[model samples]
Target chain A: MRLAVTGAGAVGRSVVELAGEYGHEVVAVADSSSAVVADAGLDPEALVTRKAEAGVVGDGDPGDALAADYDVLVEATPTTLGDAEPGFSHVRTALERDRHAVLANKGPVAERYADLRALARDGDGDVRFEATVGGAIPAISTVEDVEPGHVTAVRGVLNGTANFILTRMAAEGLDYDHVLAEAQDLGVAEADPSFDVDGTDAALKCVILANVLSFGAADDPADAREFTLDDADVEGIRDVPGSALRLAAEDGRTVRLIGEATGGTVRVAPRLVPENGTLAVSGTQNIVQIETSHAGRLNISGLGAGGPETASAVLSDVGRLG
Target chain B: MSDAPDGAPEDPEGADEADPAVDGGHDPGSSTHTVRLELVDEPGQLLAALQPIADNGGNLLSIYHERGNKTPRGRIPVEVDFEATADRFEVIVGALRDEGIAVMQAGTERYAEELTLLLVGHLIDTDLSDTLSRIEADASTSVADVSLAAPQGTAEASSARLRLEARTGETADALETVRGIAEEKGLRVVAPLAGVET
Candidate 1:
């Protein structure tokens, strides 16, 4: 399959760099400002180097690459909130033209899911977003395999930055500010870190999962309920002091920012889990726990974020489309 | 036993000395007893009847007080379930009778289930004892144990871990009781994942 990639970020560059090894060709690539389009396959090294040194992928208009001939459009742009624009528009263009859209952006799926579903239904192409939930863990696909109707609930430690901060605080007996600073220095958490710690990021991911479960289980798509960030009951770890963790630890337990999504609701909060439990993943790691009817509880754990880690999920999504 | 009156059971010994073994030989370690009493439909009558059970080291399990259901004498019927040693069970019954409360029946019963959670906030300022008393007074729930950590001082934010033993199948009601208290006090509660034992 031929791929047209957008947003020259870490994930986009990694997808372009690794597409060849996966037996796929990158026909067009675009960043915010420029685009490089070729009827034949473009050179991965040249495009990445141009993006590095020249700060642009090519001289063509970014819209030109959207019009380029490709089988799948990979939307790896930074996620935006309401409307989820540029990324949503990019996906819409691909589906409108009967081309598949694989997304690494959470905004489109988390915010505008019904719109994307409507487009996918009308067009001949399919839509799959395995990367939007858990980076390298096969969370979305596993839920799909179990068949959403049979699954009771999907929950996990979805945010690595929040988990890292909590883990360090419990281990070192430090306050939230002190451990968050250490996490920022180690690059485990962003400098701003509001989205990760304030529970918005985790809530968004759980909202996406709730959308999948709700829509997937419904017999008719129109009758299914759609979830957005506003529907979630979210609580962050910012107010969780060291004393809380200490109190929890004394009873062989610890606090983690756990996000849960069922067909009807979405909630994220600091919950007390056993000290060495499966959901108590240490450091920058993630775990997805699925409760199903036929099959018992299933747990999937791995790196939740990174360039190649997330890009791998995108490429596998493409492979699934074929 | 079938022909006995509501407030009085037919037995050789007095109501307080009813045999635990005769009610079906339950485990010897501890046994639960259901004691039915008649109240005068007064304000402190229910509390007056329950004070003896708690004062005599009985683990109160549940209290089914139907205000609308009254005896022919205009007295209210209240059934209380509690767990205690065989000797303490006798002592509690004696205490209730000594308080001028009628004892309808005392027989073996069973109660089981426990929930653990954490509360985070200015617990000292909010009157931790009052918070606990309110929880105990709300439902058939009792705070089995509590561990408080006020490392930063009593004025700052603190945390408390509470282990509650509730009647079987009443976990949801017990949690709701705690959540209501926490919300009113402006505190945060970290509850365990329900039905998922880690």
Candidate 2:
């Protein structure tokens, strides 16, 4: 299959690299600034080097990649709220052209899932966004596999940055600020880490999953619509006092930032995860727990976000297009 | 472990079927052993104590986290029961202590055989709860079932039938605890029942 990626960030670069290793031809690749389009397969290595050296993937306009001859359009751009523009438009363009869209961006799914589905239905193309939620953890596919319409709830430790800070704070008895600084230095957190620390990233994933559990599966007769991030009740880990973790620790409990979506309601808050309980996962690890009517409770855990880790999910969705 | 927590198990209907250990459903290739650790009531300490069990290939059967019960060191006594091959048990225990956790005990738990005994004494004069506790302390013994025939009321002589599960080799240890309590309370002990002479 020929691939066209819209965002040449960490995840996009990884997808290109792995696609080459897996023998998939990437005919087009684009950064926000520029794009490289080839009627023949584009060199994945040259694209990576060009992005690093010139800050642009190639000299061609991104419009060319969008309209390029490709079977799949890989949307790996940053998430935007309101209309989820650019990523949304890129995906829509691919779908309108009867091309599959595999997204690592959260915006298109969380904000415009219904519209995307409608567009997909109107055209011959379909959309898959496994990387939007649990990176390479297979959260979306695992729940979908367990008989459609049986999922009662999906809860998880979705943000690895928050989990890393919390785990370090607890283990070292350091304050949140101290651990946060250490985390930032370790590249575990972004310099402006408000999005992750404020739980917006997690909320977006939860909202997307909530949309999937509710609006996905055309035959289920469940409401087919998007669940915007605004509908989620999100709280960040920024204000979780070290004293609170200490107190819970005294009771053999640990604090974890848990995002839960069930019954049309979604929330992200710091809660008492039992010390030895299944939710007491440490460091940057993530766990997505799905409760179903038929399969009982199933848990899947792995790296929630990373270059190769999240890219693996995007490529898996591409392979699945066949 | 403890019935898969309060709300975790999917089946509410057959949730209380039986304990997994007693059902002989446990893999015969591996045996059950309980590790006792006193953890500082800190956030990651429990995870710290439990990681080695998983790292050493010990499958956790149940965790008896005595959060309310603390040692003189102001730490909680957590008993984690797990299944591992005999060879891995030592490594698991070593890993637990190497994490700087206090391992109170780590050994095979054999409370499988059942034994019944009779104790006759003053109904309420001596504390029955204390007597029962002592009979179970540091021994592979648990009161599986009990019957008290106290027709004469709380102030009179009452005999109690106690059915206990014990490690076959450690039956004498359990019986000794009962005998010690019986001697202190001047209670007549009639042991060695017909069917449970072992």
Candidate 3:
């Protein structure tokens, strides 16, 4: 597939760089300020180096990439809430031109799911967002394979930063502040870790999962329930003290920010789980556990974030479009 | 079953006594019975309590001894399941009580499910005892065990791990009750993932 990539973040860069190995060509690429377009494939090394040296992908308008000729639009922009801005508009442009769209941004799928679906239905393109939920974990695809109607629930430790802090707090008997500081130092958490620590990031992932489950299970797309971040009942790990982890540890358990999505609801909270259990993935690892009606329970765990890790999921979605 | 709290299957035994032929669910005169007992946390207390059921022609089924959990009076809570005729069940209850064993609940009123959760915040300032009693006051739940950690004294934030025993299939209700109480108290509840066992 010929891909037009947007948002020059880690995911977007990796998707551009690795598209060749995945047997695809990146015809267009864009960051916030600039874009580059070439009918004949763009050079991955030149793009990456240009972004590093000049802080921009090219001299073309960012909207030029949206109009670029491509078979798939890889929407890898930083996720935004509410209207799900420029990312949603980027995907809409692709589908409007009858090109498939693979999203690394959670905004379009999570907040404006119904609108995205409406666009996909009217156009010849199909939408797939495996990366929007569990990074490298094939959560959405596995649920698709099981057939969403047969899957009862999908849940997991979706966030790495929250899991890392909780794991360290339990292991070292430290409070949230100390472990969060350690996480920031290790680059596991961002400078303003409110979204990761406050459970918004995980909630967004579950909201996306809930959208998938709801839409996938409905016989008619019109009958499905659309979920957004506001529909989630989220609780962060910021308030969890060392004493709570201590109490859980005494009972052979620990805490993790677990996100769950059923066909009807989405919830993210710091839940007590068995210390050695599958969901209690240590460090920055993530786990997705799907409960099905006939096939029993399915668990998928791996690195939930990082440029290449998430980019790999985006590439896989492109492969599926083939 | 592990979650047969309040001995659901045993309740029919009582109704069956009036019309054994109508029920025909179990053996003509034999059915399972679960008795909740408060035994003194002592070496021979369990054996002494069980002897009554066996002495009264009740065949032991299973014993769930919660030694770590205690009643308000500090007595260990034990749940004993057994198969007995309707007539023998009455005798077993009488015999256990006569032996000074506090039969907290007998026959059909047993808790079948257990859940543990952590509450963090100003637990002491919010009247933790009232929070617990409110949870207990809910017909479907009882406070099984609690371990409190107040590292910075009672005035500051503290944590308490509460183990609750809820009637069969009422774990969600029990959690809702606790959540309501915790919300009013400004406490954060780290609840266990329901229906997900390791």
Candidate 4:
């Protein structure tokens, strides 16, 4: 597959490297300010090195890479909340051109799955975003094994940063602020971290899962009826104190930032998880539990963050296209 | 069991009988055991259910998985005939349960041993799901059935009847896993002095 990546961050670089390792050609690459295009295929390692050293991937702008020729547009750009801009428009552009778009950016999928799928249906293009939900966990593909309508619900600890904060507070008996500081120091939580600690990240990922499950009112760019982030009742771990964790622990349970979706409804809250239960996955790791009507409940857990992890999912999506 | 055919033992009565040597998949203690299983009607269901059997020393003889007929549970009814020794049969059934593959019936062998106990505590409030999961996660046990009694409501207190199936001598190990969960949850465990309850 010939590829063009939008984000020149860690995930985008990993995708390019893995694509090259898997023998796929990276026809174009871009960062926030620079875009590179090579009809004969760019050297992935060299391109990544250039981005790191020069703070730019190439001489051109992001629009050049978006307009560049490629079989699949790999959108790993940073997520935007409201309109889900650049990422949303890039995917729309790819589909409009009858080309495939594999996404790692959660904004577009959480905000526009209906519109994207509707567009893909009208054209020769299609979309796959396994990396959007649970990072490297095969949340979408594993559930795909069951017949479409058979999956009753999908639930999981989707946000690594939120989960890390919660788990640390629970285990160390520390308050949210202390744990947040620790997580920030460990590089698990970003400096601002509002998007993650405020439940927006998990809500977006849950909405994406809802959309992938075709929750009917699945989330969309238009913020459709059923599964929009607006409709989701999200409660972040910010207010959950270490005292709450101690109380739950006394009862042989722990609190985890759980995201849930059954049909049109999607929510993210601190749900009680068994200390040893399958959903009790901790730290920066992520886990997803899918309840299928037939095949029973299936749980998938693994590294849910990192460039290679997300890229691993992106490459798998690309492979599915092939 | 068939006696090895000696040169002088080619009797007239054995003319139409099946030759043990020609049974194709025959081994010394191997017997064709008919095991019934209920599986989900989905792709890879049969393979997932059958892999454990093969892994635990059961050789595939035939699969009578009926797609048209489902069990009362609405799952596909699959009847499998396989060749395995008596001891191998015990391991096979346990493995099936470990894989979460429903072994509806495995010939005359049903997990070799069963242990049931009474757990009294706040099952729901203290997270009964976690308690049950920990026991099930132990390789030695699987929760065959559970009965919870919370007449006073979930807040007050509750007791559950857990039917656990263990490998032949692993009943003690299964009981230990149960005991561990009980101790951790501040729950009381009641063990019957009688032989065993079905």
Give the share of true interchain contacts found in each model.
0.73, 0.00, 0.69, 0.00
Q: Give candidate 3's chain B TM-score.
A: 0.58
Worst 10 residues of 1 chain A by lDDT: A246-255
Model 4 in CAPRI terms: which quality? Answer: incorrect
Error of 1 at A203 (Å): 0.9
Among the numbered candidates, top DockQ falls to: 3
Best by TM-score: 3
Model 3 residue B87 CA deviation in Å: 12
Q: Which ranges of candidate 2 are over 4 A from the true structure?
A: A217-222, B1-198
**Per-model TM values vs. the true structure:** 0.82, 0.63, 0.85, 0.61
- The lowest-lDDT stretch of 10 consecutive residues in candidate 4 chain B is B189-198
**True-structure RMSD, every candidate:** 10.1, 20.1, 6.2, 16.8
**Candidate 3 ranges with C-alpha deviation above 4 Å:** B1-109
Error of 4 at A103 (Å): 0.4
DockQ for each model? 0.31, 0.02, 0.39, 0.01
Candidate 2 residue-wise lDDT, B64-102, digit = tens:
998888753377988898776667877887687567676
- Residues A1-322, model 2: lDDT tens digits: 9999899999999998999766688999888778899889988888898888889999999898998999999999988987999899999999999999999999989888788878987899989999999888998888678744788888889999999999998888777789999999999999988988999999999998888887754464335545898899887877555544554465456677888886578988766556667777899999998888877778898999999999999988887778
Name the lDDT value of residue B194 in candidate 2: 21
Task: Name the better of 1 and 3 by DockQ.
Answer: 3
State the lDDT of candidate 4 residue by residue for A1-322, as single tens digits: 8999999888999998889777689999988888999999999878978887889988897789989889999999998866788898989999999999999998788876667777888899889999988899998887677743688888888989998898888789877899999999999999999988878898988887777666433334344343567867786766555655664565456677888876677888766555667887889999898888778788889988999999999999999998
Greater-TM-score candidate between 2 and 3? 3
Better of 1 and 3 by TM-score: 3
Model 1: clashing residue pairs?
A: none
